[model samples]
Target chain A: MKWKLLFELFVVFFKIGPISFGGGYAMIPLIEREIIDKKKWIRSEEVSEVFAIAGTAPGAIAVNAAIFIGYRLAGFLGALAAMIGVLLPTTAIVMLLGSLYFLFKDNALVEGAFLGIRAAVVGLITYAGIKVARTSIIDKPTFILFFLILLSLLFLHLNPILAIFIGALAGILTMTAKKKIQQKREEKTHFQNKQIREISK
Target chain B: MILINLSLLFLFIGVISFGGGFAMIPVIEAEVTKRGWLTTSEYTDIIAVAGMAPGSIASNSATLVGYHVAGVPGAIVSSIAITFPSLILILLIAVSFNKINQSPLFHSIFYGLRPIVTGLILFAAIKFAISNGLIASTFSWQMVILLSIFALSLFVLLYYKAHPVLVILASGIVGAVIFS
Candidate 1:
């Protein structure tokens, strides 16, 4: 029974490789169908939770979600199975294209094509940055963090790894502080209400 | 060997890359470019090709970078190295999933971490724009042409919501016509 579950996890993620077109965001529906509807492995809400965690965790959403769902199902081996299933097909496809690129990269026409593609890449990455900002930069504080971190990268010569560390630290400190302040404000309001009742009495 | 270096680099990348594939770019650029394993232009090309493939663009690019540097063995090593950190981290987190579920502290950390990733990605885009000569130190006709392509691609992506592969291919054809 355990082995069967692992195998199923592998097969399912292998099938997921080709359909991940558009971007990682687009794969939510496909995962919903395979894991939630067809397999009944999880519920709709649970899938979103998984994707949320997947999105927050480091790595690609598809692979992270696969590992999460697989571990949820069958533990360690399930994770390995699902991750391999995800990477195998992707690696093969990349290698095939990689070989062709290496072979013709020196050709003038290919260089032109690559030049144009590089320009487009800048656009795509920027678009992706905007998409992330839409979600991550919800408040003024978050926007400030985004701005400061960006400036650090561009001017401060900050290591990207350090930026990630600092970012997580900032998130933890500020958000926790925000929650505490809100708690205090609520407490103050509650205390004032008690005073008003006593005075009236 | 260089292969070992490659593995160590990618493994580090897998750990630090919060958010997703785009989040991985600035780190990959820093390490890979420093090592001279790949050039900025080549890195951009890998991103484009990886986007066409299924799965994570980050991992796909790692595979391409590996192959570009060493050979088939390098590709295999990079694929494994890039993915290994994810497996370890997931296993650890999955075991403690219940604790993380209720931890407001954990949630807040991600809330903070994400915007940093956004900043990093924007940094990467700007860096690539400068490095790949889309925006150059000394302006030229080629720079103008590249900027136009960049503008057109960004416009189509944002306004029309066109598929990225089509945009890449369309840009390639435009490049072929103009440059070649």
Candidate 2:
């Protein structure tokens, strides 16, 4: 059973490493289908938590998913194996391709091929952004914040790191304000109930 | 000494690269070009090679650059370093995700990040489009055909949910027929 578990982790991640197109974001749905629905290795709630963690933390979402899934399946060693499995195919391909890169380095055909890929890649990135925005930007404040960041990056030529920092700060403040309001409402209700009990006594 | 520094330079590419391979370019250019390890044109060529390679562009480029700067050891270190940030962060997140979910503060941080990430993705798209010669190239009839192919691919992707590989393959065929 242990061996089977290890092999399953290896095979699933190895297959995922190569075929995953559109970089990190697109792999989520496929991972969801395979790991959660089909394999039942993890539940949906856990998948959501993993998604949040993977996106919020650094690195590629796909790699994070591999770590999470591998850790769930096995342990620390499983995470190591899963990382190795996920990286192996891409590494082998890159190393081999890198060696021969200069040979066809200027081949117009290869250039044309990449031109096509770049176009599609652009579309994929745009699609991904739209999807993420649709899911996350629900409220008016968030909607405004999204457009403001876009304008700052486009017209003002502001640095992205600064923009992200500012945005994160805004979110923290907004949530804190909401929390304070809720706390006040709760306190008021408690005070009223105490006064009523005192009057009755 | 310079070569050793170059290895460390590529190591930074691995660490901060979020939003995918494209996001690393500005950061990479700043560090590598500033240090004179690679000229702008050489860096562009490397990017081209990265685009053609089958693996993740950032990883592949880091390995190739590492090899060019030093040797096999450079490649190993750069590759490991580039991937390390993601691996370690994910491991930590995996351990803490369940507990973190209960925190509203965590929720708000993510809520703030969503829009910013979207903005970053859009910025990346614009940058890639310009770099790939999509924007500056003359608007010829060839471009018309290319746009048609792009629109068709987009429609198929949105309306029909056609597999991305097929869309990409078809775009390649269309580009060859028209551009060639």
lDDT top scorer: 1
Candidate 1 local lDDT, residue A103? 91
TM-score for each model = 0.92, 0.74
Model 2 lDDT per residue over A99-190, tens place: 66556646777556555655665565555566567776889878888888878877787766576677778889888988899999999999
Model 1 residue pairs with clashes: none
Candidate 1 ranges with C-alpha deviation above 4 Å: A1-5, A183-201
Give the 10-residue window scoring lowest on summed lDDT in candidate 2 chain B: B47-56
**Per-prediction fnat:** 0.81, 0.45
lDDT of 2: 0.68
If you assessed candidate 2 against the hidden native complex, which CAPRI class would it receive?
acceptable
* Cα lDDT of model 1 by residue, B1-180, tens digit: 979988998898888777788888888878888888878767888888887777787888889889989999999999999888888887777677779878998888888898998999899999999988887779799999899999999999999999888998999899887888
Give candidate 1's error at residue A165 in angstroms.
0.6
